[model samples]
Target: MAEGRSEIRLSPSLRGRIERFLAAAGPALEEFPPLETQKLVSELYVHQMELHLRNEELRRKQVVVQRFLHRQEEIQSEERFRSMAQTAIDAVISTDERGRIISWNQGAQAIFGYQEDEVLDQHLAILFPERYRAACRRKVERRRFSGMVPFPGKAMELHGLRQDGGEFPLELSLSRWEAGANSGYTAIIRDISKRWALTLALEGAAHKWRTTFDAIGDGVFLLNLDYEILQCNHAMSDQVRKPFGEIIGRRCHKVVHRRSSPIDGCPFVRMKKSRRRETLILRRDDCWFKIAVDPILDDDGNLRGGVHVTTDITTMMLAQEALKETLARLKRNMDETVAVLAATAGSRDPYTAGHQHNVAQLACAIAREMGLSPEQFEGIRVIGLLHDIGKVAVPAELLSKPGKLSELEFGIIKSHSLMGYEILKRIEFPWPVALAVLQHHERLDGSGYPGRLPGAEICLEAKIIAVADVVEAMSSHRPYRSSLGIDRALEEIFQGRGVCYDPEIVDACISLFTQKGFSFGQEPFLILSPADETGAAQGGPGPGREPAAVRSEETPVQKGKSAAKKSGGLEGRQ
Candidate 1:
């Protein structure tokens, strides 16, 4: 039995305990049977074997449990990675060394329009457009050899093909990795068709806007809150006589005014404070500009900057000033000419000495009282001075006659108005001076005139002159009569108002002498030459008197000849 049994291996401590047990039991067993001792030893060996077998089985079961736990952890970790990739917005794709698709997440499936089952094991080049397939292959080969990817770890834009054979823009980032002995690649991709289209559209709009800005005729500027120029049009560059590059980014004052600080009443400063538009006329180097500053605001209604527009108005301003100067000069010349002409006409008719001067003064006062414009008043005054110019054509004796004149003599005197019109029509006066001269003798009632013009038919200026003439002729000494007095003159016009005189003119004259306290000066008539005499005769009727008769009716034909000769002389003088 001992030969048949294998050797029992035990620990030193166990063997010590077994030997101590044998020593204590050996004397006790000496009285036992030999067969019984052997049998007991055999049972002790069997029990030791059973304990060793149980320990081995427990160790094997523990190892199996550890493996199972490790595998469960690994499965959970893989699930977490796949879930992250599937939920991501960007497409995630994995490929093996041969460039065959190994993994396609949900994002990849949506972006490529392909199912995972349909794309698995498919070549990665299938997702690339035909035009880009060769380039992709080249990059893959290069990466495998050099351990470097095309645009490694950086996003690149390229064309991608969908399952429906449609192509679109995509942004891709490629990275390489290793799993055991096999190398693979992961690509993070995103569809960028909308982004790219929007970018292109914005670029086109910006280009068009820039083109229009430069094409403007007025100077334009975009300025920040600090008044620094952010952008400027070509017109602005030209306005400042500087290049666009030099003007941009510089302070507006520095660029435009050549100053370090803002100008007084700076429109930009005002606009900034008020958050409103401002306009101003500015002059620089003899040039005038109308500048408009408009505020720029952000989406939140916050003031961001301003836009400035400047229009050149130099030509318009200069033209207006020149027109004003010309008008003033013309007025001065007209006044001087009228004075000279009145003095000349008065020199030929001394019986009505200073007649034209007094009439002109009174007419001007009437015009002022009537609230006439300066130009109208001036016309009335000039016409008053020249109203009797036709009397120069009358014979001196006929003009100075002191008795009632025959019809033939009165006819000759009435012809003077037509003669005056003929003479004056040749000159170009700004106002209707000649026409007023012709019509001054016309009456509103058609009862006292060469033309018999009545009422509104006569010009306003002519009516004013007629009123002044009547007043001055009656108040002053004349060849045909002594002074009738100002009261008699006023009475005559008041009685003849709306009959022979214009009511408006009559009222204005009355207001001037009465309410306005206007009076005529007694300055002696100006004589133009030695030939002009102070005793010269005039042709109009004196106050409240009939037409004067010639001193003699003899030699009527000779008288006509003499009157014609005198008219010619007067015409020559004019």
Candidate 2:
């Protein structure tokens, strides 16, 4: 056993100490046995080698424990990374440099409708549309997958193919990793079908709105309170004869109206103040423009801005102005013709030269005082002016006679009313002038005239003229009679009120003479030259009566008689 273990080496310190002990006790222990000494050295050397072997055994076990612990930590780290990747909302996929799918997480299965076992080792091109497959293949060939490719591509939008063969839009982010000499790629992908559709819908709606705005034919624009043209349609450019570049963002008055500022009473100003629609008619150059401004409001009912619409109305307005001018010219011509006709009739009886014309003035005044409208009174005036126009048909001797005439002459005098109707009925007057003329001598009780028509059958115009006629006839001087004065003429109508005349008209006539200052001369008359007078006479006493002196209360009746008078009383007069 000693020889078997004798190969064990002695420690340097033990060998050195044993040699020194022998040297110090030189020959003192020479008597000790060689076998015992060899046995003792061998035992010591064996123990030292055994201790070093034991220490080496413990170190080997320690290395094994450290390796096992480090391996567990690595396993835990891998599990943590896998758990994070699986639960992510986006698809997490891994592929080799060959572009074959190597790893698939739960999100990848959910997004692509595939189990993890279904897609491993498959080409990554399966996830992309056919059009994008070739581009991805090209990127893979370059071994630099970035920017719209599979590796290190930051959030790029691309088409994705699902297990169902349906294609949809997706957002993808890419990253690459290296394991030894080989590389792998990870892609984070998100389905964006709803988001993409929403973006497209918004764009379509905006395009449709702009199209509708450009379809209007009239000039239309949006305006703010400051008169800035916020937006305008295509037609607005045509109206102002400018391009959209010049008009938009400029003031409306400056762009459209060609003014430095808004004009007085501008429709835009009015619309803002009133918060309602308003219109303005403007004449620019040779054209007429009608501007319609409508208000725009906020949801809270506050005035925000306005919409201005413009229309061209030059043709219509110009026609109206021309028609008005033509009518005026026609009226002047008619007046001249009427003057000539009035002068001709007056020549036949000198004393009543302006009688019909003066009757016209009084009749119009009475019609107004009675609350009659302008339409009613205007007709009355024309009828009164030409009331006695038929006297021209009667003999001068009969009309100018000083005393009451024979029954034959009286009948002839009464025929003048019918004759006046015959003369006027041929003309197409807007009013019933002819009928009123024939009924002027007619009474309410059927006690007078060529027609014995009662009050109800008489036109209101004829009644008004009758009151004025009687008053004028009795008050003015006539060749056949002296002036009876206005007091008696007024008394005549008052006494005949509701009997021979209309009560309302009588009251209106009285009010004029008493309450309102009315004189027949207040109106202008058609006066003929002395050359046209011929046998016409001036105002004075008639027949055997001397000229009456002017009384203090001479009365408007005397002055009015000069406006209209008959040769005799109601019994016989023209």
Candidate 3:
């Protein structure tokens, strides 16, 4: 205190505050300082002002450093985002509020076939199909200020235009982003061409199958294991007299049969047990239906359910019934005509009254043994019954004479075959009846009367008749000759086999007598098994049962006739 002045020191802030107070209180405070102290107060004030200016400069530089650090962080964040978008399989695009392209990722470049340099600053509408371009531009313009909201995860589908001018389907999802005074939209887009094509193909296939299902004329339905109809076609609806809507999702039995349970003899029920197709003919509502069931199996071959198909067979059954009646009537009338013809021819010769009948029966038996078809045998029988018809033209005394005929009478007998052929040729029989009658007396070795055809020229029917006529004539009573007995008759044909008669027909005739125990006057002759084509020993109707035939290959006797009918290449059954 004593040495005239006290020293003073202050921090910059303190100095500044004190200087502010000194200036604001300057009139009194200026004098309060000692004269030396007062002189330095201005210098203190000047130093304080310089320090304040330096602090203001430092604060301004700190603000600049903070801004630089923030900009670096933003740059790093944007680089990371760009990297992610570049690697994405889908297109990623960024646009300004004006919809101008600002950033295009590698994915977007690949999808759109455009480089970033080419697309940058271009309108986003360049990537949209022509139809969508104007709409997209108008949409962005309308929302230029507010921009779009943050899009949800769901994507919108549209068509995208490519650099090649081709359009492909696209799925677009976008989100809104804002940074300071800047705001824009980022969109993720996917190419959906393959997916769209697959969907269309599936729709087309479904349409084709549905069309085929409905086009079927038969009533068809898919049945589950529970017998419920999962689906039914139009024909099925028609059959049940119900709409398709009423049939689906209902029990099959309830829909078709109008029953609580399955109908009796239901093919579906039988198929469950057999696991094979089962069919049934059902008659209901005056209509005939053929119901066929096929099983649907799983991959393991286990039965799953069934497909029921109902076909209307009313017309077919009725036609079959009508045909059967027509055939029966024709058969009866023909049989009567054959019997009458035989009787009229035999009437002239009193002893040969039953001779023609005996010959016809014996010829049929031989034909049967020789593996002839029913048609061939039938032709043989008809020819045998009428073989002597020409005898009717002769005087009654000549046929009934008790002595051997003169050479002139024998010549007359030989001419009967041609006469019978001439008479029978006028009728339209289904077989070669006239030719067979004409050749019945012809011999294989060219020794017999009339045409005297060789074995090859003679039809199978005539060959059979020749052997049967000889055997029957020798065994039976005749006015011109004594009964030689059955053994002698068979021996005659057996010795002449392949000489005067067809060896096959001769052997067949012998077998009928020796093995088959066949005789004349028997009402019912044997009708062998249809499968005895190899001449297996079909059991006889009565006492006669023959062993298996000796012939190894007995070809169909009427194969030529059957073929002729098919090709129209010959006369009637020729």
Candidate 4:
């Protein structure tokens, strides 16, 4: 029955099924022509089937090629990320919110001395020193609560632990990072030993600069552009007579002078504007400060502020002024002394008393009219008084001789001018006081005595004294002659103007005497003696002669022995 069932069925449905199945199995079976023809047809069908299978295989290969290219793209992308992570200098480390290390790059390994295998899946606390663990944990808790790390672009210096328990300084910048569905922190760390060294060096430099500034002996002050005192050393307070606590952080003008603001001539402003050092004279009560304001510059050459250095010059300036005043006083005192001395010396003759004083007064009047500085005037006054100082060495008998002097006696009297210079040259004085005495007899045209210097060579003071000597000797009663009137005295100077005397000075003298009605006898002379403290001798203040006080300054020569000397010597001499 099995063999019969295998035979072909004649029912139409079954037969069609069998035929279709046979044709599918072998297409040549449906043809069933001759056996040999069928074999040939089957061969041809098999050849076609083989060709279709080759086409299917080709399609499958194309799909495989596309998949390979897609996979290669993925591999390249992963390689690029790995390369960046491996070569980056800044440590790239990732940790879970709970402080577990999840990923670590080569940079992290190099900086922390740990391999990825040693740190990955480990607690983040392993990297922190034991002491910092609490702090680090607290920071992480804060970060988790805020969903942000405290550090971003700004890096914080800290210590990093190595795999071998070693430590190093590092700058760490932390940020929150998300990987797929997981949250973590990324920390970028840089070894910063070099930066730390620089920071220390900068601190040291700052300390040294402050020390140097404070150690200076001179008064030092720092001011802002607004002339506000920023800082000051102890010396500044001492010099200005103000306390440092009161001066610092206050406007300089207000603190120094108790004013509301800076004055127009404030030196700090000028220094800041000019970016250069400027010197100013500061007047305090009876003292002076030379304030030098120098610009403070930054490394980039920008003006930052100013440095004020104040030098106390009150002593030196006062000394100079005192010296000037002393010379003046000395001249007047000397004139009075000489007048008294001459009176004593000439008491025997009686007629020659007050001779030197009259001559000196007339000479000073002439010199002042010639327009000289106070120093020059003082020189003239001194020479006029001392012109006869050497005559002290001359015989009293010859001086009081009443009759006309012999040629030898006249020559001896003429030698007094030279002798006076030699006597007075030892005394230190400004403006060649002794030279004026020596050259008093000299003429501009070289026609006078004692090395007669001509024109400019003759001191204006000497020329004036020469004119005055002739006038006073001729006008006053002398032992040998009668008095000549003032008009005759004027003629000598007027004729000798420019040729013997300085023309301008001679003109001033002429104006004073002739036009200004100045005369030696205008004021009566008061008696002065060593016993008279109120007198014009002994360098005390006289009746109407007093010194004017400088603003906010103490007198250079106070009312003491020095003051006495100055006042007594120069009183009424000018």
Give all TM-scores, in the order shown.
0.60, 0.58, 0.66, 0.56
Model 2's alpha-carbon lDDT is 0.77
lDDT of 3 by residue, 354-432 (tens): 7777888888888778888888878878887887776677666666555545667656656777878888899899998
Candidate 4 lDDT over 350-453, as tens digits, reads: 43436666766777676565566777666666566566666666676666555545567667766767877887788776667678778877877887678856
Candidate 1 — which pairs collide? 350-536, 405-549
lDDT score, candidate 2, position 52: 69
lDDT of 1: 0.75
Off by over 4 Å in 2: 1-218, 256-261, 285-288, 350-353, 368-377, 392-397, 405-419, 438-457, 498-500, 524-574
In model 3, how many backbone clashes occur? 0
Q: What C-alpha lDDT values do all the predictions have? A: 0.75, 0.77, 0.74, 0.66
* Of candidates 2 and 1, the better by TM-score: 1
**How many steric overlaps are in each model, in order?**
2, 8, 0, 15
Tell me, by lDDT, which candidate is best.
2
Looking at candidate 1, what is the lDDT of residue 544? 30
Ranking of models by lDDT: 2, 1, 3, 4
- TM-score order of candidates, best first? 3, 1, 2, 4
Q: For residues 387-445, write the lDDT of model 1, one tens digit per residue.
A: 77777787767676665556677677777777778878888987898898888778888
The number of residue pairs in model 4 that clash at the backbone is 15
